[model samples]
Target: MESLQEKNRGYGSIFRNLNFFSIWIGQTISVVGDFLYIIALMWWVLEKTGSTAAMATVAICSSLPAIILGPFAGTYVDRVDKRRLLILMDLGRGVLIAVPGVLYFLNQLQVWHIFVIAAFLSSMSTFFNPALASFLPVIVNKEQLVRANSISQMSSNLSGIIGPALGGALVALFGAGTVMILDALSFFVSVIAIFLVRVKVEQVFPSEERKRFLQELMDGLNFIRKESGILGLVVLFSVLNFFVAPVGVLIPLMVKKILKMGAEGFGVLGSSISVGMVLGSLFLGMIGGVRRKGTFIMIGIVVAGSFLALFGVSESFWTSIFLLGGCGFGFSFANILVPVVFQSKIPHEKQGRVFGTLGTISGGLRPISLALVGVMGGLLHIQMIVFLSGVLVALGGLTGFLIPGIKKL
Candidate 1:
């Protein structure tokens, strides 16, 4: 058992646990590479094809694997040696990512090549995510979950700050092929960090605990159906995501058409949101998060929507940046709290499936919503669409609170 002081240590205490820190640093580096590579890929594709279809293919290929494979990935995660799986996945992905960089260097890279790599990486991600999520609680003390997650979010957010700016600079100075090598190397770093962290026997499922894979998957869905709070939370996020997806497609248009901002100005707005995410993540990590988890989450939904709406209405370039920053801050709350609440509620054995299912439901709407919004933009004022979308999200996020038990958590 941990002492009061130990439990209260928050983010600072996470470093003292070398196991968590190693994975944290490794994963953060990996995230930086991911963003950097994405910018390089997008820019290269645009330069080559000059087609929106090629760009949209990137989004579709990236998401298709997750929507299709997440549940099975979660099921297997519950059955496997999670540490081994993480290491293997990292190794596999490192090799795969490097293939493209190598091909590009040889001047053999084609636009179709990007789509192939995206599909493979997306498939592997389904396994990597559930394995990592389920594995966290095994290594860190329960008291440290929130801080640990917050730190994780902080690192990823930090990469969002660094990745694009740095990627653009490096790609310009060096080239896409060279910058991609950096992404490949980050995985090696991740694998090394995972290797260093000792996986306790208790962390692995007992052989006797194994069940038929089909049953295991069903059990995961059953868990969600049985828990009203979890069900409500899932529904809240799904509805929120459905409404929020349109904003992603609309934001760039808003900046260009409504605010009369140039590409550089739009980029600045992105950086502001990333900055806010980093700050919000750090604040949560340092404070160890709020005790009234449910209430905080509810407030986050409203705040996110409120700020998003403000961004829609604001005429000043700087004002939009501030509101978007707030939107990012609110997202940090949702990102950190949703997982913590799930970890607290679900049994460890079932976490992979639950989180996987939750992730799919939450994320599945994105591609659909993006398409719907693009079509809707043709008929409605994009600004009106954005404002109404924000309104819906704010309303949907609050719906979880109306459930009887969620507020008490």
Candidate 2:
């Protein structure tokens, strides 16, 4: 057991756990590469095809795999050696991502090629994410979960700050092919770093106890159904995602049409959110464990929703930046701690399936929400849409308190 002193040792303490640190370093590097891939791929497709529909295909291909494969992928994750699965996923994605770059240099890359690769890579992610989540609790002490997750969130946020600007410069100087290759190399870095970490997993399910695969998947859903808090949390996130996902699409329209700001203003607004997330993550990590987890999560939801609402109404560019930043800060609490709660509440063996189901539900909402936002934007004012979404999000968060199961969590 971890002593009180060790448990209370703060964020720096997680770095001393070599396994967590190794995976952290690898993932941070990989996330930067991911951002590079996004920028390079999107820019290349749009530039080459000059078609918005072509660009939209990239989104559809990337997202469809998760909705299709999520449950089965989670079932596989629970049955496999996570470290080995993770390595394969990283290696496969690395190789797949390099294909476009290779083909580009050979003058053989096509729009269809990008579409296939994006789908394969997204399929790999369907496996990698739940495996990573399931693997974390096995490798570290329970006391370290929050700080560990916080540090993980912080690195991704930090990468968001650096990756695009860096990718844009590289794409300009060297071209998308070179950027894709760099992104592939980043995945290799992750593979090597993860390889160095040692994890000893105790098999909780005996061969005799193992059921058919479909039954196992059904069991996971059953667990969620029985656990009212988990069910409530999942629904809350699904609803919140439906309301918030369109903000990404809306922000550009807001800046261009409503705020009368340039591309620079759009960039600044995006960065403001990332910067706030970094600070929020850093703050949570440093604080270690938090009590009254339920209350904090609710407050986080309200704070984020309130700021987003304020941003919707604000005419001043600077004020919008500030509100978006606060919105990001408020989001961090729920983002980091909810997983911590899940890690504690769910049985280790079942985590992969449960997280996968939750992820699919949330991820599935994104495309639907974005599509609706397009239709709604045609009929309503963008500011009104933003304001209404924010209000609904806050109202959704407030419902958590009303649920006896979630309120007491």
Off by over 4 Å in 1: 1-8, 45-54, 103-110, 171-175, 201-209, 248-267, 286-289, 313-317, 373-387
Alpha-carbon lDDT, every model = 0.79, 0.81
Question: For residues 1-409, what per-residue lDDT tens digits would candidate 1 score against the true structure?
Answer: 9887765585667788889889998999998898778767766675676444466566667777887888888888887788999999999999989988999999999988998999999999889998898888888878778888888888888887788667766766777898788999999999999999986634344257667788888877888989887787777777788788766556656666778864445446666777778888877776675787777788888888888887877778888889888988888888898789988888898888877787787778767765665456667887787788778878876776787666876
- Candidate 1 deviates by what RMSD? 3.1
Lowest-lDDT window of 10 residues in candidate 1? Answer: 199-208
Residue 219, candidate 1: Cα error in Å is 0.9
For each candidate, what TM-score against the reference? 0.87, 0.87
What would the C-alpha RMSD of candidate 2 be, to one decimal place?
A: 3.2
lDDT of 2 by residue, 225-265 (tens): 89988788887888898888766656656776778864446
Best candidate per lDDT, number?
2
